[model samples]
Target: MNRPSIARPRRPRNHPDRFLECQRAVEDTVVSAIGEASAAGWQKDEIIAAMIAVADDMQLALNAKVLLSVETELGKLMKKYR
Candidate 1:
């Protein structure tokens, strides 16, 4: 049975422009969060920790997206071969 396609924001594989846009969006979010945290009197260490946590979360999310894309392509190849 064919799996239903889920619509997602896909970055074109032929260009890095969308990838850069994603990075810029992440950076903007992190900066804004840090500013708010600082304004709330978060200490330097606390702010750095928050930044690191955000970065880690972003990396994990990116990795998961790449894995999902690879898995979908692999499934397509398998079906084509079968």
Candidate 2:
């Protein structure tokens, strides 16, 4: 018996051009940072660690923002329903 495949929800295709520009800027910054680090004689492990640290910090900030947004929406919903 063959299993049925599930259809995944597709992402919307209406993202703004600013997002693309921001993505390109981030890519360029990462590339430049890697090149500079290498030129400064940073070890492979050191570069990897620095990148991970930066990523972790960004993740924390994003998580906090998401949490705050969720809480604000929940408050609005509660007020509306009450």
Candidate 3:
């Protein structure tokens, strides 16, 4: 069976752009959501749900461009990556 591969963002490790920066950005958003939810007496699951929603949006936006240009889903998927 062919499994869908997840896109892994990689910034320059040696240069100023570090791959972990992307990870950090995602964490920061999640943290901000959690803090706001906590301040408003909202459940922690709300933050998790928001994060998942944001991830889907991000993926759609990121993939939309390549999705239009490529012929096959595999090709679009490959180009959407890096």
Best by TM-score: 1
**Over the stretch 11-81, how does candidate 2's per-residue lDDT look in tens digits?**
34565665565555466566667777887899767897899899999999999999999999999999999
lDDT per residue for candidate 1 within 1-82, as digits (tens), equals 2223333346775676877656655665666666777878997779989778987999999999999999999999999999
Which candidate number would show the highest lDDT if scored against the true structure? 1
Question: All candidates' TM-scores?
Answer: 0.56, 0.53, 0.48
- The TM-score obtained by model 1 is 0.56
Winner by TM-score between candidate 2 and candidate 1 = 1
Q: What is the alpha-carbon lDDT for the whole of candidate 3? A: 0.69
Candidate 3 lDDT, 1-82, residue by residue in tens: 2223334557665857565666665665557657777778877887678778998999998798777666487787888996
lDDT of each: 0.75, 0.74, 0.69
Q: Model 2 residue 38 lDDT?
A: 83
Alpha-carbon RMSD, each predicted model: 10.9, 14.0, 12.8
Candidates ranked by TM-score, best first? 1, 2, 3
Which window of ten consecutive residues has the lowest lDDT sum in model 3? 1-10
